[model samples]
Target: MPAVSSPQPSATSQPHHRFIKISRYIYVFREFSKFSIWTPHVSFLQSLRRLAPIPSPSFFQTLDIVAENPDKFRIVGLAAGSNVTLLAEQVKTFKPQLVAVRDESLVNELKEALADMERKPEIIPGEQGVIEVARHPDAVSIVTGIVGCAGLKPTVAAIEEGKDIALANKETLIAGGPFVLPLAHKHKVKILPADSEHSAIFQCIQGLSEGALRRIILTASGGAFRDWPVDKLKEVKVADALKHPNWNMGKKITVDSATLFNKGLEVIEAHYLFGAEYDDIEIVIHPQSIIHSMVETQDSSVLAQLGWPDMRLPILYTMSWPERIYCSELTWPRLDLCKLGSLTFKAPDNVKYPSMSLAYAAGRAGGTMTGVLSAANEKAVELFINEKISYLDIFKVVELTCEKHQEELVATPSLEEIIHYDLWARDYASGLERTSGLSAVPA
Candidate 1:
């Protein structure tokens, strides 16, 4: 880890006198002294209403930012789940030309949201709906948000359509990198990374000439169990495992953080995203998550991207690549150096978090092996979440499944071949849960 440079300004130069108030997506600057500020009673209640944390607003924030410059960027298509009624209503606000949803039951609800529109958008439903949205003639880019190997097929479809990809789903690259990468190259479309860490690496090396880059340093939050001793990990409960220290994410991902498999998956993703060798891409546990990721040049200078851990910026960067758009709605404060206290980095303990090593092993092995690794981890995470398996069993399942797939490892696997290995590994991992012994859990 390189020495972290402090970003603090001198007391005279810094604006510390004004008190900071942050709501879900807005920052309110006011005088620190209550007597100096004027507030109306009705406005005070409205401010209180805005204080509740917004429900996962990364995608919506991107939309809102794009909405500001409707001419420069258009929200022509969408694919989303949950709050379909609300999402559709919002879509009506943007009034995209097309909309897609996985839940067929919500189609009517979506229609109701757009009932008032004079020119209702085309509604596409189910799996084909996802592909249609990706391949829509009006669509210029695809945002892959679906989880696991499920995202790979649609991502491929979007790539074939020559749609630039804003890759939020890590599994697309993890399970199907060999096929996806080639497809992207053949189509000559950009597969922009939307993950914060990967986006940070992308931002760090954006203009720098290739080959001058020596290594990619991915920072990890070290997850829920980072502080636990080696022996304590086996006893970790599912609820306990879901408690990630830094990021607010889905259960599967949260558990992945606990096992360090999230970082492991990122290791493979970074390998494909940046074309860095598995040996060259390294994971360092940075608990702060302030510095998203770093790049080491051939001359050994390290360039890093630092910000508050907000997904909106990264997602926005992908959508507005080559142009940094001003996103006023995402009004979070910038990283203040003096308040940071410290940014720490340490090499991961491979013995405790064997998933990290398994990722490297899978990357080194290549082909369907990485697919198998991801599938196995997904299955293991599901079982662990269901409480059918213990926390440490996550690593056990991934390791066993990957070892079993060594015989099935194929170089340059086709899409179907990758899916085959993915399913095989998932089943293998699930089967291991029944017969796996307590002794199999790593120390």
Candidate 2:
């Protein structure tokens, strides 16, 4: 069984300044439009013309929540990639003191975009710039939304600075848990889950007695191919995998959902977040994602967190933790069980999702194997999306990559070693497309 420990205490004192630092890799406007209620009103955007520095619309809900109580919360730093035009527009609205683009090349473009502003923010570029934003002194909490192992270093940096982590990036724990958890413990930093499932578990276990938790039930909205026969998987197209039934997410995550890799990764995350063993955490196919997650106590009593399948509630909770911020019922609609009629659950099919066993095995192996699994899956998904490989090859790529890493696996790896293996796994997984003889899907 994997290691399990109770939640650690957060830092003793909260910071006097209420500043937020956001770090994200990409921003998609289409995903933002899905949360209709959280959308910033046109008048609100117009009102911010006099001020500056907002995030991309993808993070508009986060910004909107912060903007609600301007005197209580402030946007102090931002880190983003590729979407410089959108990033620049946000910077002009929110007025963060510092901004960091993905690389040096994007710095000039971001600067040029902000040249017309009356108040110019200090801009930095590349990985180091993201680190600076993570450890910004004014920020009490840093939101880690950057995808993949790229988010690891900055998240570690934030913990070192004693900043509470609003954890949206799965890799921060899925890949770096062994390294990051100890570091977080050392600094007394609070790691708040910014996703629905983990947030659901975190909420239910809030006041539970130590040693009371017996099991963790993570709900899954059985992805695009949930109802499709197992034999039909080989015919899965790139577009097919991208069409997630419930959540509007990034390309990588949407595909992850279809493969059920997202839930597998979350199983490992639940182990780290709530200190439950691999055997204690289970996934159930819940077609309707109303019940985010549940925890079975020692008395066999189950506690659950329920809400409509919207990301706003979870994200808002991460921002306004220990205190629930009131939302207008008109905008933030209440969950009406009568309208929903019913919620259902069934066991996940192991044959349909080999990723589950791979995740559990890697998680049990501990250290570098989990990171390898994640990196390989990421690369495999990218290959699949590009039609370079068939859908089934995603599992083959990840499993073979993990197998190749077994000999070199380090149970107690340093930050450098974690990063090294992440890169190695991606490279190895990429090479599998050629050597593994997996047929590529016709473009």
Best by lDDT: 2
Per-residue lDDT tens digits for candidate 2, residues 85-194, read 77788788778787877667978888889999999988888878777877776654566766788778777877888766667768988889889988887787667677
Compared with the true structure, model 1 gives a TM-score of 0.81
The global C-alpha lDDT for each of the candidates, from Candidate 1 onward, is 0.68, 0.74
Summing lDDT over every window of 10 consecutive residues in candidate 2, give the lowest-scoring window.
29-38
Task: In candidate 1, list every pair of residues with a backbone clash.
Answer: none
> Cα deviation in Å at residue 316, candidate 2?
1.2
lDDT score, residue 91, model 1?
68
